[model samples]
Target: MELLLGQSETQVEYDRAGTIIKGQEVILPKRKHEDVHVNNHTSVWGLWWKDHQWAYKCCQQTIRNTYCTGSAGIEAAEAALDFIMKTY
Candidate 1:
């Protein structure tokens, strides 16, 4: 995904006076771990799946004054999957 550092071309409508903001786009790397057998004593660790890779970007805006906020690139894609699986 590409990161855009300016106001969105399309304005968002809001019911309240507060501004509607958009987060930056980020591309997270995909990772996979090897599985371990319960009977095998040689394996020190077990395989695990990560919801999303870690990536971050910073943004700044000037309204009455300049303000800053941090954003993560990875999408909230794992939320639904985790909820369905009942995983913490």
Candidate 2:
């Protein structure tokens, strides 16, 4: 699925307040445990925004690993997670 970045050329519509009026729906898939890694280190994390607040969810890795918050929002976080899952 194509992830929407809200670019000017995108087919998305925005209101005066810069909110998403209409566009493609975003669906972030769940990753299998063996499919996720961060820079060769096992990591599992999640990010979301609600009511102007940011929430993060993460699980500890039992091995030599690290959990890092290198993403901003839900989309970026999910995209990064997906890339890592697919790449490593």
Candidate 3:
């Protein structure tokens, strides 16, 4: 989708939407160990819920903005995508 949209030569990492979860940490969509979403369909994406907020990670980077969400996982991915896509 990004390629079709001319969103640069984005690397479509091989991963599914099961990288976000408690007691697990996924890095760069490779599941380095384990971790955090839903229908993320993103290459580099991970999410964690903490302190009433969601921790969004992408492209080997993590940002919370202290971004918060009523739900974790997918919602976190959504929030992270919003920020990462816009800022970077």
Query: Judged by TM-score, which candidate is best?
Result: 2
Q: What is the lDDT of residue 35 in candidate 1?
A: 33
lDDT of 1 by residue, 1-78 (tens): 245665467645544765544443345855434332222222213221233422112221112112223222123334
For each candidate, the alpha-carbon lDDT, in order, equals: 0.33, 0.52, 0.47
lDDT of 3 by residue, 1-88 (tens): 7677876653444347755444434556565533433234233234545566444443222452333333455576678879999998
C-alpha lDDT (0 to 100) for residue 21 of candidate 3: 44
lDDT tens digits, residue span 1-88, model 2: 2455543565888889988878966778897764676643323433434455443333222223444433343467577779999998
After superposition, which runs of candidate 3 have C-alpha atoms over 4 Å from their true positions?
Answer: 1-71
Candidate 2: which stretches are off by over 4 Å?
1-9, 32-62, 66-88
Question: Model 3 misses residue 82 by how many Å?
Answer: 0.5
Q: Model 2 misses residue 17 by how many Å? A: 1.9
Clashing pairs in 1: none
lDDT against true structure, model 3: 0.47
Ranking by lDDT: 2, 3, 1
lDDT of 1 at 14: 47
